[model samples]
Target: MRQTSYFHTVIIGAGAAGMMCAARTGQGGKSVALLDHAVKIGEKIRISGGGRCNFTNRNLNGHDGSPYYVSQQPRFVRYALSRYTAQDFMHLLDKYGIAYHEKHKGQMFCDDSAQAVVEMLQNECRLGSVTWYTGCTVESLTALPIAPAGYEQARFGINTDQGLFYCRNLVIATGGLAVPAVGASPFGYEVAKQFGHHIIPPEAALVPLRFEKWAEQGFDTLSGIALPVRISTGSGKQAVVFDEDLLFRHKGLSGPAVLQISSYWQPGRHIMVNLVPDTDLAEVLCRDKVGKKIQLKTALKQLCPVLPERLIDFWLGREPFQAVAGQKWADIPNALLQQLGQSLNHWTVLPTGSDGHKKAEVTRGGVDVKEINPKTMQSKQCEGLYFIGEVMDVTGWLGGYNFQWAWASAVCAAEALRADEHI
Candidate 1:
């Protein structure tokens, strides 16, 4: 018979949320067990933000009912987020002397390395005396018929490669299927399903958009070119827009703009991009055509000085512009120039698909938030079963919003778990 390890709380997936919850719960004097199949934990944190880790966003309004997050229940994040704001996480960082700096739009990244954040979480776990079960696979999990002798409220029996762990609370922080190379799995969703909870169909989000016939469209040659653009998907109330840098990739569109809009994008929907966001391309082209004796291409290059020469060449080489390429700007009709401007301003393209989970920074959907209690991060149907972080349906915008959700939701769950012990 395998020896049973009884803990007040048993949390799975030792990534961001799991670590945070374990540290808090253990510190609150609850016996905690943190488990993961990965040999090295925090791989996601280590590789985020080009290795520095965009830990959280400062612009997150924990109080003002901001819609920075996406979910079926969009307002579900309010309570937890307000309960544990980004400033609270920063305070934790400040306590550890972890040097961090804001990059842009309130995105915060570590100054040295993301490894430091991982180490800090590990140290916090150690301070709380949380047991570590790294590289341990859970074979099966069963709800206990009766509470264990010492742990009167223990309701879960988790059988793992390490041993059987009985706990009063079970937290599924296994995260979502984003970067599968870092050990992302469906374990959390599976657990949620087993507990009679609903899961929103998961999709790759914060990933690059890939177009069909990308090379045929002449985008292949403009791979390294990047420009400030306004990108949008959908329309009206459903329309999502971002004014950020757009990068041309060998396969498709990427960079901050594409990644942000990708979250709201759906198949069969065309995305529109204003290549010259700051200037009205049509007005400028028609106005500049008045006296310029330069070739149409040169006029375009001179007018949109922000665009790279390679992109201008590529743009002029395509469609209606191809015929007017060699014509003098003064010789070209205002109507054609205006048409050229319209094309540049409203460049609409349909993305065939995305780079998928392999390249996605985060997963868009998971265990449905509607089925989880916002205040406690606990399941509405299952007692003592909690879900937090990316594993839940709440996904944030690009930058550091997702990390803020992870921290906020984890702390909320941890606090609830701690309070439950006394009850």
Candidate 2:
């Protein structure tokens, strides 16, 4: 018979949320056990934000962070986010003397290596006296009999490859299926299902949009070109937009604008792009045609100076523009020039698909937030079972919002578990 160890809490997945929860719970004097299938933890943290790791965003302060998040219950994030703000996480970082700076739009990244952030979390776990269980696969999980009367007893029996462990509280922080290379899995969703909870169908988010005939559209030649543009998708109350840099890839569209809009994009829906967001291309073209005898291409260059020459060449070489390419600006009709302006101002395209989970920064959906308690991050049906971080349906916009969610939700769960100890 295998010897069973008992802990107050057994949290799975030692990534951002699990580690934070363990640290907080252990510091609260609860015995905690942190487990993960990966031998080397925090691989996702190490590679995020080009290795510097955008830990948290300053924008979450003074405002409701739920607006920046996507979920069936977008407002579900309010309680935890309000309880544990970004400032709280920054205070923790300050305690460790981790130097970080805001890169863009209040996105904060470590000044040195992302490894420093990982080390700081590890140290926090140590301070909490949390037990580590790396490279450990859970074989089975069974609910034990509830304690009688006023007796405190282990509520969960988790059998793993290492050994059997019992805990009063079980937290599923296994995260979502985003980057499978970093050990992303659907285990959390599975656990949620087993305990009678609903899961929001997960999809690849914050990934580049891929077109069906990208090369045929002449986008292949413009692979490395990037520019500032306004991108939007959806409409009315559901509409979402982003004013950010757009990058052209051989396969499809990427960069901040595409990634942000991709979160709200559906298969059959169209995305509108303003190529010349800074100026009205049609008005400018018609204005330039008044006196200039210059060729259409030269007039376009002078009108929209911000556009790259390669993109202009590609744009002119394709479609209705091809008929008027060689024609002088003064020779082209105002109707055709207006048509060209509309095309540039409202360039709508349908994306065939996305780059998928392999390239996605985070998974869009997970265990349904409606089935979890917002205040405690605990399951509505199962007592002492908690879900936190990206494992839940709540997903934030690109930047540091997701990390803030992880920190907020983890702290919320920790506080709840600590309160349980006093009960």
Using all chains and alpha carbons, the TM-scores for the candidates as numbered come to 0.97, 0.97
Task: List per-prediction Cα lDDT, in the order shown.
Answer: 0.90, 0.90
Clashes within 3 Å, all models in order: 0, 0
Q: What RMSD value applies to candidate 2?
A: 1.8
Clashing pairs in 2: none
Error of 1 at 220 (Å): 0.8
**Residue-wise C-alpha lDDT for candidate 2, range 256-330, written one tens digit per residue:** 999999889999999999998989888888876877778898888888887899998998998788999888899
lDDT score of residue 267 within candidate 1: 96
Displacement of the residue 334 alpha carbon in candidate 2, Å: 1.0
Alpha-carbon shift of residue 366 in model 2 (angstroms): 0.9
For candidate 1, the per-residue lDDT at 277 reads 87
